[model samples]
Target: MTQPDNTDDALIRLFNVSKRFGAKLALSNITMDIHKGEWLYVTGPSGAGKSTLLKLFYLGEKTTSGQVLVFGTNMNRLARREIPFLRRRFGIIFQDFKLIAHRNVFENVALVLEARGEPRAMIAKRTRNILRHAGMEMRMNAMPTTLSGGEQQRVAVARAIAGQPEVILADEPTGSLDPKSAEIIIGLLSAYHKRGATVLVATHDTELLARREGRIIRLEEGRLVSSEPAVGEAP
Candidate 1:
């Protein structure tokens, strides 16, 4: 696949990319551009390589072939010491809601600021503000184990947005939530997108894919089969 011709404003680009796990090819010859401030959804059935695609963006897994550029820097060329810096520009939400088991809600969100060496006062203020906005403020002192799936996902979102990252990469963020919970999670991501952050969500949810605003890219057997505006959307 060839990349989009006009990528001057792209935030991430993948050129002739492929990924393999042992003998299985997870993604094959994927060339695409994720533009700045564009909301995108990577949709496919299970094992369609949606997760692998998102991982490549964050360098959680390197490509077996070709190049990936984020913010115009080649991911393959990024030094080991510089990986953290590259990641700081992204806020990732995992399907499992990877919060530290022992950390309270406040501590979990504050951890991002702490890693960036934010002052205690600043971390507290930022963490509290995001949590309050996420409707998790009342659970600030609660442990992950005590929260329901919905609450845990909310906390995970709070943590992701605490640093005001430039891009958000969410892998099945609402996979385990009820319909109402899913709405809340998507709404939060949408709010961030409206604020100028680029957002990409990998989901298999039919309802989510039906949303009319985002650009939807569908994958099948590791190949990009379609790229189109959401239903009822123009272009």
Candidate 2:
């Protein structure tokens, strides 16, 4: 299949990518080129390895056998020390929200910038701005546990974007939100895509796909069954 003509016409490329847990074979020869500045949905039934695929892109997991390239470097051949450097291009969100209970929202977002050795002034400015964009500035000093589920998830989203990564991976971000909250989060992500970032949303939300601007690929039992263009196709 032809890949999208996006910002980095030669961005993330996966060729015959597969992963296995012993003989379980979690993914099998999944190949695709994810261009820059495109929004794609990695849709699949349970146990289809969608999560595993996302993990590989973020360096959280490695492929068992395949050539995985990000930017221009081959991941499997890279050194352990290189992994952290490679992941700077990505922002990730999970269903669990992964917030530290003891940390307030500002601290949660600040943690990312701090890890990268960003200056205090930069961290404060960026964290505050990102929280405002995420609509959580007022809750900046509130603990994650003190906020509602939706609010906590927004903080996670804010932390991810505070760095302005080249790629954003959202693993079931809207799974437990009310319709209004889901739209708010989803719309924010859509806006990011519009501003030119590679986005892969691992989800089963057909409703969102119905309004997609990129493409959808479905995985079944670790095998890619089909690929389709988004609804409008911009024709």
Candidate 3:
């Protein structure tokens, strides 16, 4: 494993974290640090615990033991009211896209701003800008079911980035798209990473894994099997 920098700058940290769902151990003792402004890939095969780890980061799932700290606060100890505040700092892209089936693209993305209590005018402005960035401007008023898989994923990306959060957590973002659409999704995430947002992606796609560059961590049966800097990024 690559030794995490022993500084006070990590954006996310896990210390001997473990999670269990009934009799099955979903994740074993895992210790890792995701630094600010870094791009990280969590890669593993099916049932290898990739999704579980990402869930832990966003507090969608809690650890059975040890601790998780985000933006310097121990999430395990955070009050329920505080979880939303912490989540606002993260943009999560789900494998299923997770869009509101009843809402139009514009309204879907606008919901992010709405949750934060932004005024109507600013929500309209930001939502339009981000949808444009994702190449979904023309589909602003279209419903999710009317769009193609790639288009829907683009909408999801737009929503994730609409808030310009400090961190982006994506799970199998391209798992369902064709090659070209997959490229577009990953490219968008890379653009954000280049602009200094911390990013963590979990996937098992080898081709997708080969095309990107970042910190690569592999998991096997819930164990941290490998951690290394991207090919050109090694110190």
Candidate 4:
């Protein structure tokens, strides 16, 4: 976990990481390195700690024990103010879009830059750029409720990437989309990866993996089961 020079080689790393809720252990002794610009698949059965692992990276939940390092800094020792700064380096997309229903798509994405204290003009410019990338430019002024599930999710993706996070953590991003829609979302994530952003998608959908390929890390019973790199996939 303390790689020092090699730490920068990876955007995320976990060392002997573990988390627990009362007597239920969520993750047990997980240690690994996710290289910068690498696309990784976190595949597993339910209750396998995929979500828990992602949470540790984003500081969404505290690790009951062990070190969770992002960009080579140990989050366990990060001060409260430092935590926010660290989170800004990585965009996290939970299972739900977590959009503010009263807000429009533009506002949902703009909030990111706003929170970062970016000026209004800059926020507006970046907001529009990310929305276009997510193919939701036409829906900018629309409210979350006015859009379909796929559209709302697109808004979430736009918001997540609008800040230019070095890493993107997606938890079942395509879980709710229909077959065709799912393909489109995954493709968008792949596009980000191709652009040199480290991407980790926690999913159990074999169909998603079947369509494309990348490095795969399977977790079962809260343990890392396998790590395989998919090279020269037909897709």
CA lDDT scores, all candidates in order: 0.91, 0.85, 0.90, 0.85
For model 2, residues 1-235, the per-residue Cα lDDT tens digits are 3333444585788888889999899999887877667788999988899999889886788899987888878888889988777777788888889998889999999998998999999999999999999999999999999988789889988988888998899999988777787788888888887888888999988777777667888999888888777676752
Give the per-residue lDDT digits (tens) of candidate 4, residues 1-235: 2222355587778878889988998888888888888888898998999998998887889898888778878888888888888889888876678899899999999998999999999999889988998999999999999998888888888898889899999999988888777777777887887888999999998997775467888898888878777677431
Which 10-residue window in model 2 sums to the lowest lDDT? Answer: 1-10
TM-score of 1: 0.97
lDDT of 1 by residue, 1-235 (tens): 6556564999999898999999999999999999899999999999999999998887899999999989989999999899898888999998899999999999999999999999999899888899999999998999999999999999999888888999999999999999999999999999999999999999999998877568999999999999997566666
**Candidate 4 regions off by >4 Å?**
1-8, 232-235
Clashes of 2: 0
**What's the lDDT for candidate 1?**
0.91
Each prediction's RMSD to truth: 1.2, 2.2, 1.3, 2.9
Superposition-based RMSD of candidate 1 using all C-alpha atoms, in angstroms: 1.2
Tens digits of per-residue lDDT, candidate 3, 1-235, equal 4345666879888888889999998899998898999888999888889999999987999999988888988978989999898889999998889999999999999999999999999999999999999999999999999999999999999999888899999999999999999999998998888989998999988897786678889999998999878778865
**What TM-score does each of the candidates earn?**
0.97, 0.94, 0.97, 0.93
Clashing pairs in 2: none
lDDT of 4: 0.85
